[model samples]
Target: MEFSWLNWLYTAIAQVITWIHQAYSTFITPSSGLNWVLTIVTLTVLMRILIFPLFLKQMRSSKKMQELAPKVQELRKRYKDDKQRLNQEVMALYQGAGANPLGGCLPILAQFPIFISMFTVLNAIADPKRVSVFGMPADVVASAREAHIFSAGISDHFFSTQSVTSKIIIGFFVATSSLTTFLTVRQSVTRSIEQMPDNPMAQQQKILMYISPLFAFFSLNFPLGLILYWVTTNLWTLGQQHWYYSRHPMPKFDERGRLIPVEPKPGLLAKLRKSEPAPAEEPPPAKPEPKVVRNQPTRQPRSKRTGSKKS
Candidate 1:
């Protein structure tokens, strides 16, 4: 029998879920609605943990970009009229700085397939009729089947079922997802503006920063689980960005790529001392003439007496 790669991947994921169910069953007492919620939360945490290295890489790349912004701006100004020159200069700048503008996005792009796979697995597990060898309760599975992974409404309510409570819950999830998306985008926009150059490119980036959040709002109708995943990711990104900014305030660089030192302001004592001139040292006292002058003085007095007698 030929072994299919897809089959192998699905089996591996199923085994993982089985292991999780076993651990929950052994340790957690009374697997109730809340327990299911906890299970989902734990699953989300595990997924996040798996992607943490990528998250760190994204953040470091972003910081490098921030650090390189000044030099990039200088290049932009130098090659304002030459698009080809600008591109070359930008690539050269990235090479010299050991930074890649696309590095920040690569991690996110890499996770896309994994995210899709996880979604498929979760959807499959939630189905009531799905074979369960991992001690997953039939009712729990049925409840999961009823649960809309993306929306707050029960999957059974696809067409006609109407409950005010369900509507309210759905509304809350939608609002929460939209609000979190907006805030995350806003925070990033603010940071970008602070780092942006005074060029057309900066203006374009600022515009996108404001516009992207509105686009994100449209995504609220996606699966509730997906929203939950996104909310967690956005919150993590926001916290990380804040921490990075606070701890490592972007250093100012000059046109020549040298970091400009921030001069320390003088204190009160230093200011007062600045106005006073330093004291000058006094010169040594002069030495007295030698006593050899006495011999010359006696000879002069004898010549004067002889001249008076002659007169």
Candidate 2:
């Protein structure tokens, strides 16, 4: 691939490392392995800090996307038969919420150029035959090549058949780097599951968990300086995420990836309702009948009967 466009990245990395080493040289040896190793670690921290805003945006976007998953699923069902239309609607939903399915990947993708450039620059530092146009002049290059973070050369690899002591030093960097990478990815995955188990990105994140740490172990043959940078980067990521998530906690989700709907809290009306029983309805009483009137015919009957007999 044509990476000429990435020359600027290499230059920036080289210059930063050069500046850091010069700054440290006031108190530390110019050729001290600790100086170069510390410079590399500092570079990782500086890069991460510069990109911290992007990291925050990426995280916020991921959260928003998860919250919008219900609507996204609705759109999918509505336009299941129309693939293109479904895509349009999904994107519309994302844009409406200022979220994107790929938003979480933006910061990572942005770092790729720097990552590649660091690899090249580290390799160049070990090779005296190469010339650098960046801040790394001949003398600086020589000092870096001769520097050692302990017994391991900044450019040495474990696979080069170096001595046992060198292997032990390189092995420490490799192990620390890989372990931190795993922890960082694991933290992300765990957070994702808690916040949005149904998030479409969660599955992709799981795959990255495996791929990221494995890639670290796979770099057993890579230069010690790059591995040192890797270790620092992971450490920064872990702390960065921990600090962010602590302040901006998200809602919990069920196993089905559904938000555990918060039960409405008791209010005045609800409290009164619980305290008082409902009034029971009653039926109206029936009306009474009037008394009947009767004549004194009872007494007249006897007398009338006598009179009629006489007539």
lDDT of 2 by residue, 62-147 (tens): 87876776676678779989989998888888898998767778778877777888888877776667765455777788888889
- Cα lDDT tens digits, model 1, 61-176, are 67677777777877878988999999998888777877766776765785575555545555555444675523445544554444443344332221222655655555565567
Q: Highest lDDT: which candidate?
A: 2
Off by over 4 Å in 2: 1-5, 76-86, 131-135, 199-207, 252-311
Instruction: Report, for every candidate in turn, its global Cα lDDT versus the true structure.
Output: 0.59, 0.80
Prediction 2 TM-score vs. true: 0.73
RMSD value for candidate 1: 13.7
Superposed Cα deviation of residue 238, candidate 1 (Å): 2.0
TM-score of each: 0.66, 0.73
Residue 13's C-alpha lDDT in candidate 2?
82
* Weakest lDDT window of 10 consecutive positions for candidate 2: 260-269
